[model samples]
Target: MAEGDGVVKSAGRVLGLLQVFAEHRRPMRVSEIAQAMGIPQSSTSMLLKTLTAMGYVSFDAEAKAFRPTLRVALLGAWLNEEFATEGSVDEMMVEMARATADAVILAVENGVWSEYIHVVQSEQDLRYALRPGTKRPLPATNLGRVLLAAKPDDEIERIVRRINAEAAAGDRRFDVATTLDAVHAIRRDGYSFAHNLISSGASVIALPMPVPPGYKPMAIGIGGPTDRLERGQEMILAEMRRLLSQYLGG
Candidate 1:
């Protein structure tokens, strides 16, 4: 390979490796990382060695696992400060988790998908298990619906059509009219909620977060078992609104 091509490949692998760490949110063995990245173990080992030497990753002798070090986190710390107050989104998600005892997710639109960028796991015994980096169809998920609500109807229709076009045969297609109706309802009600839409016996309540111009739109959501979320919907919405108003000034 050309020297420039090699450099780009290595850089992509480095970022991909970090993404794996972010998604799992735990120490990972070399084999696990290789399997997750679909790369060779030797290549993964070399990357880990380089990162360890750079003080960006550390190896645990006892557990035989590797984890990103504080240095990796510090790399993006200033970006958080520049955008939203550092830890403000995290604090808001944590507070919502505490108030509802359910999973709280921060999501943004990525193409035609709603990607969960961060998640606070539920504390309740019976709850849905969600992780950061999970993606849901923009028209099919409550979080996605709130995000779609932020867009114009014409744009939403285009996205729904694109999603349908890309869907495999036998997969459910998003009905443009129904999706538009849902988006209208979300715009009117100022939030989105659904039961047993994505997962059986699960429900989610989501609201769009205000973003500065040029920033990607985001949605915050609380999810849990249908019965529990239904029972606490009012309280959860109140707490969500309160925290959003407090931390995000919306």
Candidate 2:
């Protein structure tokens, strides 16, 4: 591999190792992490050592395992604090999560992708939930459409091309015409609703949020099982629209 490709691949491996630890939420032996993440034991050991030096991972000599340190949690603390300081979104997410009994998300555009910055999980046994920092292509998803609603048609199409190009890196392709049509509809309605777009058996309702200065465009979404979200679509959209209107002044 070329130098650049090697760097990127190494970075991905490091992230995947972190995910393994995060998912299990426990200290794990190097061999266990290597097996779970499909990484070579030698590479895993070196990466773990680097992370340990950075204070993002800790080693337990007696247990012969590794775990994420508190520094890992501290990484995003400042940004999360900013979100809470926004005043309404934190409190509003609580109410919305209760009202819909589904996952409530605060999402924003990051380059050609849409990312969930905060997620409030549903109380129900069956619900759709995504960890904060999860990212997806900026088309086809309700949250992505809502976040890009303010752009002109031409600009939206350009962004769609960029998003599709990015997805192409993973052998994924999106229909340009269909995606543009979705963007037009979202622009017309000032909101978006999609079924089985983000995930199988899941539906989402997303609307633009009133973002403060210096912040990127943002949206709020509610997601749940397809049937439940469909049945409560009217109520969910009404409540979210009302909340946005309060902050955005219609």
Candidate 3:
């Protein structure tokens, strides 16, 4: 591999290592992390040592494990602040939850995946329950399609092809043509809605949120059972627009 390409690959691995900690939410032994990530033990040890020196990970000498430091949480704090007038994403989530009366979430594109950064559960008994930091392919739901619709067609096609190939390898069924059609619809309508796409009897409606000029695009969405969400689709979309306009000045 070329030197530059190698550097990029290494950087991605480092980020992936950090994400493992975020997802697992616990300290892990070097061998455990290596096994989980399929990285060689020696290489994982060296990487952890470097990360420790950089203050991004902390070593627990007593437990012989490593965990992510507060520094990792602070990394994305500024990006969240950029979207809020008072710099509190929680405030926005709270408002969206109250207005939508369903699960409200904030998500962004992570490669060809949609990563939920924040979530507020619905008060209703029959609502979709999605945890924060959940990552899924962009074509799986409207929460992802809203962000993907903003990308150029060529880039969208590439992401779709890669996602489908991965799905095929896993023996999962995915329709690329249908996903492309949904992308085009999202592009035209400036929002997206999906019913029973991510889970049985669940539905989602999402729209892109306005951010500062150079910030990566992020979306706010609401999810609930298909019967309730489909019944209230118009009202939910209207409330989402109003919420975005009120707080974000979009």
Residues 1-250 of candidate 2: C-alpha lDDT, one tens digit per residue: 1124346877777777766765566899999998877768998899999999999999999999899998887776676454444434556787788877898988889887898877878879998968766888778689988877777878878887776666645556677788878878887777788789857899788888876568998988998899998888889988877665554443
- Quick one: how many clashes does candidate 2 have? 0
Q: What lDDT tens digits, residue by residue, belong to model 3 across residues 1-250?
A: 1124346867866876876674466899999898866778999999999989999999999999999998988887886666666536666677878987998988988888898876778889887887665887887778888888888878878888887777655544457678789989988888888678878898888899887987678888898888888888899988888777767777
Candidate-wise lDDT, in order: 0.86, 0.78, 0.81
RMSD of 3: 6.5
Off by over 4 Å in 2: 1-87, 168-170, 245-250
Instruction: Score candidate 2 by TM-score against the native.
Output: 0.66
TM-score-best of 1 and 2? 1
TM-score for each candidate, following the candidate numbering: 0.83, 0.66, 0.67
Writing each residue's lDDT as its tens digit, candidate 1 over 168-219 gives 9998799999999999999899999867898899989998886767878899
Point out the higher-scoring one by TM-score: 1 or 3.
1
Q: Give the per-residue Cα lDDT of candidate 3 at 95.
A: 83
**Lowest-lDDT window of 10 residues in candidate 2?**
80-89
lDDT of 1: 0.86
Ranking by lDDT: 1, 3, 2
> How high a TM-score does candidate 1 get?
0.83
Runs in model 3 with CA error above 4 Å? 1-81, 171-173
